[model samples]
Target: MAEEKNSIHEELIDETVATETVEGEAVEASEIEGEETISLEEQLKIAEAQTKELEAKLEEAENRYYRIQADYENSRRRARLDLEASEKYRAQSLISNLLPAMDNFERALQMEVDGEQAASILQGMEMVYRGLLEALKNEGAEQIEAVGKEFDPNFHQAVMQVDVEGFDSNHVVEEFQKGYILKDRVIRPAMVKVNQ
Candidate 1:
């Protein structure tokens, strides 16, 4: 009887240990599943943060690209306009230099002549003056008429203001030096006497 009681007690203790072991294993499995879910959530959060950072970087890069494109376009437009303006005013410097020579020629042709030889020389000078004037005309240069016209500061410089007979007030009486214009730009203003 004692041995049988001992066997029954040993069986009960073994069954209780087995039941405790099973419950411990079930608790450990649940803890492991919860840990895995937390780890997945953390990984997803990290991935989303990284994605946002990359999107911001992409937008910044695109904005920089657009700004550089606009700068290039503006630079190209400025260069083209500079080229056109250079072409438009190509002959201005040369014409400016030749104006003094033309003035000297006109002075020479104004001298009094005494003989046939002097008259022939004067005729030759006149022909040359006409040719030079024609060339200037072809190049878009023109003489501004100053005599018997209204004296304007835009085209004439009044060196002397005087009372004159049969002339309107604020009109030009006499032009001492001629003025010239290249296109719409005045090269020199005419030196003139204005009637008051």
Candidate 2:
């Protein structure tokens, strides 16, 4: 009987120890789960902050790239304009130098021719002058009309004023030296007599 009782008591003590160990294990597992949840939340917050910072940096880089592209396009446009201007006025100096020679030719043609030979020579000179004028015209050189027109300081230079009965006041009476225009710009102004 004593032996049976002692076995029963030992069995109860074993059961109690097993229950306490199981409860301890359950509490430790719950604590570990709570820690994991807190760690996951912190990681998510850190990742969100990094994403926002990267997005901001990307936006700034894009803005800088667009500005550089716009600046390049403007510089290219300016260079093209400069090149066009230079090409348009390339022959200005040569045309200016030829003006005196053209004046001399005009003076030679104005002289009187008495004989048949003189007239023939004058006709040949006139033909040459006509050819020169045509060539200049083809190269975008144009003559400014002065006589019988309103006098304008932009195109006509008045060296003298005259009182002519037939002409109106402030009108050009005579052109002494011819003016020329190249393209849309005036190369030389006409020397003229203005009516008072």
Q: Number of the top candidate by TM-score?
A: 2
Q: Give the clashing pairs for model 1.
A: none
Judged by whole-model lDDT over C-alpha atoms, candidate 1 comes out at 0.81
28-53: candidate 2 lDDT, tens digit per residue: 33234343323434544655566568
TM-score per prediction, in order, is 0.65, 0.66
C-alpha local distance difference test of each model = 0.81, 0.81
lDDT of 2 at 119: 95
Count of backbone collisions within predicted model 1: 0
lDDT of residue 7 for candidate 1:
62
Task: List where candidate 1 sits over 4 angstroms from the true fold.
Answer: 1-67
